[model samples]
Target: MGKLLLFLSLLPVSGLAGEPVALSEKTYDPSLGVLIIQVNWGRTWKCGQFEHAQLQALTFTQLPLEGANSVVLELQTHSQIAAENTFLPYAYVVQPGEYQLTDFDVAVAKSKKEVIHLKGAKEDMAKAPQSAGTFTIQPGEIVYVGHFGLDCTEEPFLWRFYIEGRSEFESYIAGFRQKFPFVKEVPVQFKLFSTQRFGNPYALENPTVH
Candidate 1:
């Protein structure tokens, strides 16, 4: 009984106190990296509509590529929120290497209820112009790419999309990390391809001067 009491006393009285500190040390695979694709658009209609439009349809028609073949990575939409309150899509557990962002599409509806039906009827949803971009990943690093969707505030509402350059992409990742504390902040350099799908047009987009 004396030995039992000694062992018990050795245990830290505040056992749970260390949990948050332990969790602060985020764990990541040494051989893998993460790729986040952010799609920011007008959630609220410019019209007098109070409720924001629902993202009815969105998908990577062409996912990330390692070389000539598609990389085996699981893509998740709405992975997390950013400082600007934008939802982001990400590819998780990606092997450390260079990858090209191939073709992608997104569709938005006025209401969440309509989005459900629009998902099944993809043909019915308005799609953003497809774009191709690229970025690299080092072991235990996280890289980001940006695609913008602009929903104009007038009739015949159209959603226009284009890839953002490197500086802009870096700025976004920096802002995102400020709000999302869980993601380990790793400096990343990205390249977006403009002309030649995979081999030709890949480099980070420069932030526009506007």
Candidate 2:
């Protein structure tokens, strides 16, 4: 999908066939599958676009298409319009295949200071990366992949990304269904698992391609 845009190129590696992709409801076609998900920066995005996130999508081989990591090609941008739970919706167009969230970027402060969190960020550290649980996407359907949130509640604040559960689905999906009438007839699945905060969002690791 040439329309895909990769915002921040954090690292350099071998090239991939396709560029990263993230689409809006206006740009989505009825033929392709629609993946709708959301993320909360934990706090308000006072700094605006400075706080960035780059999601990569890899081929079935799971190899680093761009470099060491594939791309999210999902909703990496924050919505000026907030949804339920102060979350932002990301609508991604995906081909039929296995996809993974190998790496993602999140902000720790009010500024656009981003930290790259590799799935297995630091081998030595006991904390594992939050599992980007698996699921499938069928053509012309809308899939709700649950909500992901960043919470820095501690005194100094630790950036953690969590996969919120179904309790939130009803609230979010209910609101989403009303906003995008196009997806009203589409089938949806609520299979969001424990995409817990495990890996070191603050640390970086050497790139190791599959």
Candidate 3:
């Protein structure tokens, strides 16, 4: 636990935002980078399971002498997207730098009336080791950051999660392109850790900042 405490100490006193905003602008400062990730949480969202899951936020902790300050990225759940799919891409503009796609928090429901907190240790939650989550981004680049999902099982409070390389889902790719045309033209990068998200499938107007 000493290591974990030390790591937490390194975090900035204040987070970037209380709630992360979705990508609305097609155009941003070319001087920065955009990091993207998607979560597939179909299993947990179906409602018959003992545990339910909700993503808190994603974190990018800057590497010393190698990158900018840490960034906390929030997301609009899949239910909010106009597209018809379980996948949700959380795109955020960030400062170009090296970072570790560290851990995140999940509010897990143990039962109809009981909820639990599933937090920390991405290495444990993801199939990939700690090293896979480390990556770098440069000015004007768009990074993929991998695609992952959560697998709900019969076990209570226990989830099967995975992390992997870029997403190859054609429909998702198309949605990404339509939403951010210029971003697609720029070569994309990947920095997401060995993956992993859930929900009603809340429908809302798309956050298209075109």
Candidate 4:
């Protein structure tokens, strides 16, 4: 009977091999004052034979300033269009605080001497760098959303800034679209937390690969 049963077990199994397993859920909590920068490439937009491609939504948080002071956000736009040619439109600056939204008119100010019109225009202009646009992040607050772009050129375009604050830095990234009109709609959140004592538990529990 045992030999007869072994002879009858020649049929194939039902399912195939090497099936994919479901991935687990993950959560990330970065250290306080840590700037998380994310960059993505977008669809290329063209102008005649020349191409005007753009880097989409390079997002990051400005680390909180230690002393009682303001921070400057700068965007550099390198262009193929010479200075002699009509100035090609490039970048703009945004200063986000606890209660207000200020937009700096980068188009108007071509030179360092030109005024930057904003709520705290005088203070912002005073701190404005000689080569680029400037906006002031008020004390006790964080900049939520900021954007600027450079024209197509062989050289790379760079945008950089600093965050100013003392104690706990608040994350103002919630509902950024309603706050800043120029920012394109996207799923992004910038959080400000203290990096001194405790570690980010969420990051430890769920690590990100790459």
Over 1-210, each residue of candidate 3 has an lDDT whose tens digit, in order, gives 000001111111222442223444643557777666655433355433654565444454554423344454433234422323244446666767765555655556666688775565644424442443554668877665544444445432322232221232333445666666655566544333422222111111331122
Local distance difference test scores for all models: 0.36, 0.40, 0.45, 0.24
Q: Where does candidate 4 stray beyond 4 Å?
A: 1-40, 56-128, 150-210
Candidate 1 wrong stretches, greater than 4 Å: 1-27, 41-54, 61-91, 97-140, 148-185, 192-210
Q: How close is candidate 4 to the true structure, as a TM-score?
A: 0.22
RMSD of every prediction: 14.9, 12.1, 12.0, 23.2
User: Candidate 4's C-alpha lDDT?
Assistant: 0.24
Candidate 4 least-lDDT 10 residues: 1-10
lDDT by residue (tens digit), candidate 2, 89-197: 5556555434444444443343445444423222222233234334455566666554454433332221323233344444455565566556666655653322344
Superposed by TM-score, candidate 1 places the C-alpha of residue 29 at a distance from the truth, in angstroms, of 1.5
Q: Order of all candidates by TM-score, from best down to worst? A: 3, 2, 1, 4
Off by more than 4 A, model 2: 1-26, 42-85, 109-132, 153-171, 193-210
TM-score of 2: 0.48
Candidate with best lDDT: 3
Among these predicted structures, which one has the highest TM-score?
3
